[model samples]
Target chain A: MSDHHKETFISKYVFSLDHKMIAKQFLITGMFMGIIGMLMSIMFRLQLSNPGESFAVLEWFLGSKWAPGGILDPNMYLSLVTMHGTILVFWVLTAGLTGTFANFLIPLQIGARDMASGFMNMLSYWFFFAATIILLCSLFVETGPASAGWTIYPPLSALPQAIPGSGLGQDLWLVSIALFIVSSLLGGLNYIVTILNLRTKGMSMSRLPLTMWAILITAILGVLSFPVLLAAALLLIFDRSFGTSFYLSDIIIGGEALHHTGGSPVLFEHLFWFLGHPEVYIILLPSLGIVSEVMSVNTRKPIFGYKAMVGAMLAIAFLSFIVWGHHMFITGMDPFLGSVFTFTTLLIAIPSAVKVFNYLATLWKGSIRFTPAMLFTIGFVSTFITGGLTGLILGDSALDINVHDTYFVVGHFHIVMGLSAIYGMFSGVYHWFPKMYGRMMNKKLGYLHFWVTFIAAYGVFFPMHFLGLAGLPRRYYTNSAFPMFDNLTDINSIITFFAIVGGLVQLVFVFNFFYSIFKGTKASENPWESNTLEWTTPVERIHGNWPGEIPTVHRWPYDYSKPGADKDFVMQTEPLKEGKTEH
Target chain B: MSTSKNNTSKQLLWIAMAGIFMFFAGLTSAVIVRSAEHGWDSIDMPIWFWYSTAAIILSSLLLIIAKWQVKKGNSPSIYVLGALALGLFFGYCQVKGWDQLTAMGMYFVGEGSNPSSSFLYVITFAHLVHVIGGLVALIITSVKSLQSKYTKDNYLGIELVSIYWHFLDVLWVYLFVFLLYSVK
Candidate 1:
């Protein structure tokens, strides 16, 4: 720990093993990836909205190759959409949200000196950085990026000649993803080990903050699921490179019969969804956990049903594994299997409902404060409820048959998993910025960012349900291809407008984040006056979290507004009186 | 940070091993499901795989002996070297088994290959990669053992490596049985 102060610039800022520095790295990189992913979405949305209209902005950004004479090439349209999903899901949400907060808060909140293994932590970030470089580099390839949609289903992804983007671009996508998986596994292993092994003396599991519990479960989900995705990616790589027929089958492409036979694309789908379904939870649970913490802190109440909230998270983690089949109900899977998936998928809603009720109960009749973090957290609950309710419609096998791959399904997931998680991430960022940077973010800008983002997020995704019910399929380059979708044109434009507004609002967050790091008002050590152990530490970042002996926790993290307390909030380190009982 | 932290690391190692187990479980499940689908071709088990399995088991046995020797406060260099030698031999046998499969018209790719053979190569090769990782650990342990780093009072590194080695051995056996039964 003493050697930490003598760290050189390269060691301290670049290739650093300190968990706090690594967390900042993850945050910055994730923000950059988010920008790219968002811009890609805007590009495609512009195409979807105007159809035949040419935008010089597209040509200016994408160049003549992708947006020739301003109209986005159809292939490039698919490429943008595919890259958008891939970047957002894996790079931004999974890595950015989980990687950033897990690295920052896990050590601070748990009262540990640093991660269990700092060297492996450094390796994790470098691997992720390499993956990010490779993925972004793929966009510069001559044939464009992998355009077979983010799912990259087999026949399209397997054959290089199947699509122009499938050539070298898909290979890079696989390689980049393989590296990303390695990074994620290393990071997940570190998180699990640190959480389980590195907790200070009194930080018992039940007494832990919901954020720590959420991160622990999120790490477990990543550990169990990411490898399955790796297996799927490896087989896909073999099929592409070595002519293995793992995911390839009988197909005559161009004019010749391919050597591939006997491989089932369904197998790829199975392996993918095994990781994929859990992936939604992986992205989501952390945000839910962060919201729980923020909400409890803001409302000045002990979190409602603390035990039940933990139970629901556990139930959700367990149920996430079995419900992968729900995504494949329309792939001609067995009806019995579909029924099983439906039962499991719908069962997940029970725990989810319990969690929502717990949040509302926590907030009910409390001295509520609408900090920026609280605003985003409330927005998270709203979006989570709306998105989760729609999942019931998509989870049913019979109903899914009618709306599979439509905007309805898109709307359900985007709101539930995508926007909600982003909101959760924002809440965490606003809440923890002081801890990370020792400065406060601009509250007015945060509020402005949250309001615009929340309203426009719903404005963007809400009407897509109607478009889906109208039988509008996703991934279409232009809706004007058929007159049946003519009615969707105006709705598409409206969605696009709202999406652009939502995307622009994030710039406010970016400005506030970076600006506050250097110029904002200096934050007090316990600015929020919250009860977490992280607030017990000094504002100045150090190698070992505390300068001296670590504090031993005597109570749960959510002890806000306890009866007969000296203050409204009591820190975790506060010892109980002789007659007092632990909460 | 403390002597108790060693126990936690060991626990973390086991949790990681469980994750790796699930990874292999996923690949093996794919093997089962893909076999049930059309265009299946089964190949006979290579004799070298049996040899590889025996070699890995022997290596695990030697590691157990090494652990016992360390407990008795004796230098375990001989047992450590023996286990390392056997681990390398197991890797050799696996490569030879692949060669045998290649000779028997079972290729991982190209016109001659089937999905079953491809899966066989994949599962075996993937296990081999882990085996190589174990071998690296074994080599380091051997070096440290020869230098008399382990005694009755402290052998956590050796213990951890042995646990991982045994896991690798058991994982290979599970994969072998899985492929053997599913190939038919």
Candidate 2:
């Protein structure tokens, strides 16, 4: 390794080969993208609540082109929704969540000096940076950003003349996504290799922290599934650019029949959902891993059923691939095939239930810390359960036929995957803040942020279920067109109010995070008294994690409050006693 | 580098190979799905694709010999150079195959194109892109071998290149057979 002392500002801060630095880069970029995505949501919610009413803030952000007279153009509403989902799902949650934690925690918890290849890690960040720029640039194009939904389903995405937002903006969206896939592949390859090969001598697979296992599995999931997305995107690109009829057929646009024939948009759906479903697990699993560790440390107990947690993760990962067809049940698929997908989809609830029960058992009859991180962990479980129950209703093809594209589906996923994953991410940030910056965040601000966010999140999404059940379809610019939806206006206003509140609460988190980075009290090495190897590292950041030899792991990472231990927590580096057995 | 670091590179290569395999798998499945539709036009297997397959297999053989020479503590420059030459020849044959495809009136796009023919073109071009990646690796390995940078104790670069080369060869053969039989 090069001498850390000789590093210049550009080398240290900009293009540094350190894993920690690369992780911080992912965090900052992900948060910036998250802010953009949230603002887009707020803008769309404003349109949804008032439906053609003027909002000066909309005019300010979108200008006269998209939000003329402060009323968001219908095309821009779809653009904001598309960009919001694309940015949050892919950029913020997938790359941001996995990229940050995987890069930060893999080497530290596994007791390695660095990733298997630091140069590739740096390349991963740059590719993501480039992809981010391209996606952002799409917004400035005359056509506006891609408005064909985040899925970019064919017929609409394939034909530029089909929609006003389909011109250069869709092309940029595809290019950005392709580049993002490359970035993730590079990052995933590094994470998998480092964890498999670079663990210190005594660290076995079973002995690894849950975070490492989750990341390793998530990386594998990415490697296997992302390439399929690349294939899908490549065909879509060919269709869009080269006049190939892969995903378009029987289309009469502008009173003219183009030559496209014999292609099925259902093929694109099949290809997309193959990656899309596993992508849900990809976003949620890392948070699950982080929450597991944080819950164990805060509750002062060994994580309930360590092997079961790992098993459930593996089961969920495997089942994710098969359950994708459930998303396509309403696409005129065969009833028998839909039944098969439904069966597989319901099977996922078994493992999910196992994980939830294990978390509850871990928190039962324990010395709970109720720290900001723990509060978020508990909040994650609550939303996970609330949102997951609705999944059962949505998973059934018969029931799903009623609420397939309704706000019910939106409400369900936001609470389950979106809210749960974000909660997990916040919990991880609060827990690891001291480790990342060597400064403590304000606990008071954290508590306030958690309470408001938790309440406001539920307040926003919970009402959407009722709206969806009342036949209020999603992706509609306004409900004013139909007199049937007139009664739901009050409910819409209430949801938007909570959404604005929820959006504002994140600023508290942002202020606390940035302020604490420089001005918060200096944190000790092991502020949380966790058993993981990361807490054993020095408070001051260094090139390699440990100053001297890497410590050898002697036990599993969940050894909290063991009988007759010197302290409440036992670091993984501590050896077993003479008569004690390895747990 | 330590043994584990070496293992890390090898493992990374294998995982990358798996990813590439999945990419092809996805494309081939699309071909199956799309061909089941009406108006599907199946093009004949081009003669040059057969020639390209043979060239890639020969290139893999030369790479294997070069790896053996490294084990015997001899300069593997000749063998590595032979492998690189054959890889270039293989790439040349692929372009010729595409020409043959066009000559047979199978267009990847435009007025004459069909989805089946387009799938064939896209799948083969994607495979060719990967072969080009392998060729770059081979070129670097050959240069290093000519400078005697690889020894019996440290030939990881050569091994990685050879592994990728062999996988590419196998991949082409499988794709060749699958396309020939499955395009109908």
Candidate 3:
């Protein structure tokens, strides 16, 4: 494992087994997917904001069949919305957030040479790469991509003749998803094995950083829950391709009755949400973990209530499984079952509250540095609280009956899980760029990116709650379909305007990220003056992580401003003095 | 140090097995719930399935013997080949069983079928797929054992394949019992 090997281009960049290179691949691919997803949202927002108005920009991107005479076809509108949700949820948030950070940080923070099985790690990325290609290929098919929404509920998804997009497009979507599941399982297993077995000497489970704990739990959740989604996908595949009635039921289309019978669509919902609810936590916990580390470093204090934070995360993971029924409360589930779900869903708030309070406690009365990472961490806390409070209303079976499938549900999830997670990701990129690339992002550009994104995010979603309250249903191509909804047209326009602005602001980050990698200020080994083991590595990336033997951990990662310490932060590799006790 | 690494790899295999178990648990639960609904008509179990079940059980017994023989510092290829042959035969019998069902007009899809028989076809087909994966592993281990790659003190590959083969054998038994009681 020497650093002086004559590495070729393919082994170094294209198909390397190094965790750092693989992590960069995930980040860049995720960013590419995020751009596509964001552009789709902006396209649909234009159609929503101005119902019948034709824009040449739409014609340029979508071409004649979809946006003839510049007006978006109604079916294509649904297609954009569906692909947007699917790509962002699965490809961007799930893969991008977890894949990028987990692969990057797991070995560095845990003091491992590499993943326990590097070959499997390489296989995982290729699976994800193939899945991405297959999914993108679906867009070029004659009928368009899977348009039954990101959930791809059956009857619509199972019966090809039901919608034009249900033909080859949906088949490709299922194949892509099945491939993605395989990739995730492979990656998740590798993370678990590496964390469980490959920690450096003295890095016990308790001494492990919060980021490692979050990733470990996230991997466990993925291993258990993703298989259920695979089963759901397989059954849907059987119904669609093999003509089995696993999810299809008695239906009449085009004056003909379908052969499918005795099967329940509710069953598909049951299976999908079983993976779907934990998926929210899966998307959020990594950011939550990153925010904890960033907040401690920037505030010059130890993370408040570290044990309680870990306990809260574990509690949230356990509670995520039982609370999925809340998503189906309005679908005529058993009222008793709904009540049980509502209780479990609301009980999650206790752990969530503990985490938020601990974050605020860490920031209180401390000498806080307002780095871009810290600002984004604060933004995450804000959106997490705001979005989370709305869940209480939606979780109540009685209240959810009114807001189900409305803009209110959309607003709640986007703000809490969507924006909060994205902010956490931004915080991580800004904080860890130095470690990853040995360069610093421009702070002024970082500040500009943060404020605009923060303000515009709230500007876009905050008003959607009122529209939901006004009884406007989601997935409507035009609010003009109902005269009663005509009054809220102005609000839709405002939301769309802010969404476009927010979407454009992301380009600043894109520019900053690429520009900083090549030309930004050079960073020292410990630029953030953090206590974590990752910063202890030299600025240059290496194969086995260290030129010599890996460093041993003598204390926990979050030892900021400890009493009797010479400096404000003590590196985890520092040895304990004769008289001082380890924090 | 090498022994600890071997243990960790084995532990990873078990964790993966648990995940596979949850997958089947989900599908089986769906079958029971789907069966309870209206318009559900039950079909008779094909006799070939019973033979396939016995073949898989014997395959598991052969693998156990192979494991025992290897640990005793003896050549285990005879038992390994015996298990692999039975495993392939079990797969052939499963295809024959499906063909028999189709002959008897119990379709997995289309007008002649009920959801109950469809569940039978699906659950069995999924298990057969995993069994195929086990067969591939068995074949590789058989080659390694013939080359004397494994020793009495280091038979991790043999042990992993045997453990996985037996798990598949046990899984098929559970699915068979479930289908027997539930599929009329």
Best by lDDT: 2
Residue-wise C-alpha lDDT for candidate 1, range B115-178, written one tens digit per residue: 9999999999999998899999999999999899988888987898999999999999999988
lDDT of 2 by residue, A1-583 (tens): 5324567889778997899999999999999999999999999999999999999999999999999999999999999999999999999999899999999999999998889899999999999999999999999999899999999998889998888889899999999999999999999999999999999978999999999999999999999999999999999999888899999988998799988887889999989998999999999999999999999999999999999999999999999999989999988889999999999999999999999999999999989999999999999999989999999999999999999999999999999999999999999999999999999999999999999999999999999999999999999999999999999999999999999999999999999999999999999999999988999999999989888888988999988899888899889999998989887
- TM-score of model 3 vs. true structure: 0.98
The digit string of per-residue lDDT tens for model 3 on B82-183 reads: 999999999999999999999989988888888888888989999999999999999999999899988888889889998899899999999999999888
Clashing pairs in 3: none
Ranking by lDDT: 2, 1, 3
Query: Which structure among the candidates has the greatest DockQ?
Result: 2
Interface RMSD to the true structure, each candidate: 1.2, 0.8, 1.1
> Over 4 Å off in model 1, which ranges?
A2-4
lDDT of 1 by residue, A1-583 (tens): 4423667889989988899999999999999999999999999999999997899999999999888899999999989999999999999999999999999999889988889888889999999999999999999999989998888899899899899989999999998998999899889988998888778888999888999999999999999998888888889989998899999888997789998989999999999999999999999999989999999889999999999999999999999999999889988899998999999999999999999999999889989999999999999999999999999999999999999999999999999999999999999999999999999999999999999998999999999999999999998888897999988899999999999999999899999999999999999999998999999889988888798888998989988888889999999999988899987
lDDT of 1 at A521: 91
- Per-candidate Cα lDDT values, in order, are 0.92, 0.93, 0.91
